[model samples]
Target: MRNVAVVAFPGVQSLDVSGPLDVFAEANRFLLPDEHYRLEVVGLEHGPLRCSNGMTNFADRHFSEVQDGYDLLLVAGGPGLVHQEFADEIYAWRT
Candidate 1:
């Protein structure tokens, strides 16, 4: 199985996160029986993230704990991404 990580944060656009996910889910249906995407929700911190629409969802892992190996990494964007808070920290982490 290929690992797929979706990076999410507070005020994230719900569709930005869920849209690609829907495609991934659909792809799995057509793949060979031995292949499938293992989707993981990763967040800046451990716990649930609040969406721009006021909905909350939990992540499977924290960004800090992520290691070097991942088939794909998707970053979800929102209005909150314009803020300076956590920017430096996240940039450093990505490097």
Candidate 2:
């Protein structure tokens, strides 16, 4: 199985995160159980994430909680994303 991590933050564009994930999930339905993509929502911190559209989402795991590496990583973007600040480690993790 492929471990897929979708990174999201406050003010994130919902589609930027959900679109790709939904595609992966839909693809899983046609594949065997063992070949399924394991999708996980990863947040910078724990608790609820309030998006730009005011939708609330809960992350499956926080950055600190992620110990294993993912086969695929997706970062959600939005207008507010440019205004937000994050730790250097978060950027380093992507590399």
Candidate 3:
């Protein structure tokens, strides 16, 4: 099974993460039930991630704690995405 890591950060757009998550969930339910991907929500820190609209999202793991073994790492985009720091962090994690 492929391990998928999704980065959830402050000010991230909900749909950016939810859309792909739903698609992956559905694909796992039907197409790849036997050998599907494992999804994990990772944050910069071990706490709640506040969205742009004030929605709070919890993370399963922290970015610093993440080790090797992930097949995919997705970083959601939003209005706050203009900040390059988050992009740099994501790229660092991906590499």
Candidate 4:
């Protein structure tokens, strides 16, 4: 199975975290039993996270604590990012 990590934060748009993941999850229904994606929500910190829409969700793992490499890493985007910059480690990871 491929490791898919969706990076989210305090004010992410609910859709950004849920939408594509829904698609990936649905895709698994038609794929081979062993050939599937393992989706996880990664946060800067591991614990409860509050979203822009007033919804709360738990992160599967803390970003800094993610030692295993993910096959796919998707970062959620939203209005809350208007004044925030991606952490330096994020850029390093991308590079």
- Write one digit per residue (lDDT tens) for candidate 2, span 8-73: 988888888889899999999999999999999999867998888888888998888888999998
lDDT of 1 by residue, 16-73 (tens): 8889888999999999856999888888766888989888878888888877667998
lDDT of 3 by residue, 1-95 (tens): 87887778888888877777888888888655658978888886568988887888888888877777688888788797787364466566642
How would you encode candidate 4's per-residue C-alpha lDDT over 8-87 as one tens digit per residue?
88888888999989989999999997899999999865588788899997889778778889898898887868887767
lDDT of each: 0.83, 0.87, 0.78, 0.84
Would you give me the overall lDDT of model 4?
0.84
Candidate whose lDDT is highest: 2
Which is the winner by TM-score between candidate 1 and candidate 4?
Answer: 4
Index of the highest-TM-score prediction: 2
Cα RMSD (angstroms) for every candidate in the order listed = 1.8, 1.4, 2.4, 1.9
lDDT of predicted model 2: 0.87
TM-score of each: 0.86, 0.91, 0.82, 0.87
Q: Which prediction has more favorable lDDT, 1 or 3?
A: 1
Candidate 4 deviant stretches above 4 angstroms: 85-95
Give the TM-score comparing model 3 with the true structure, all chains together: 0.82
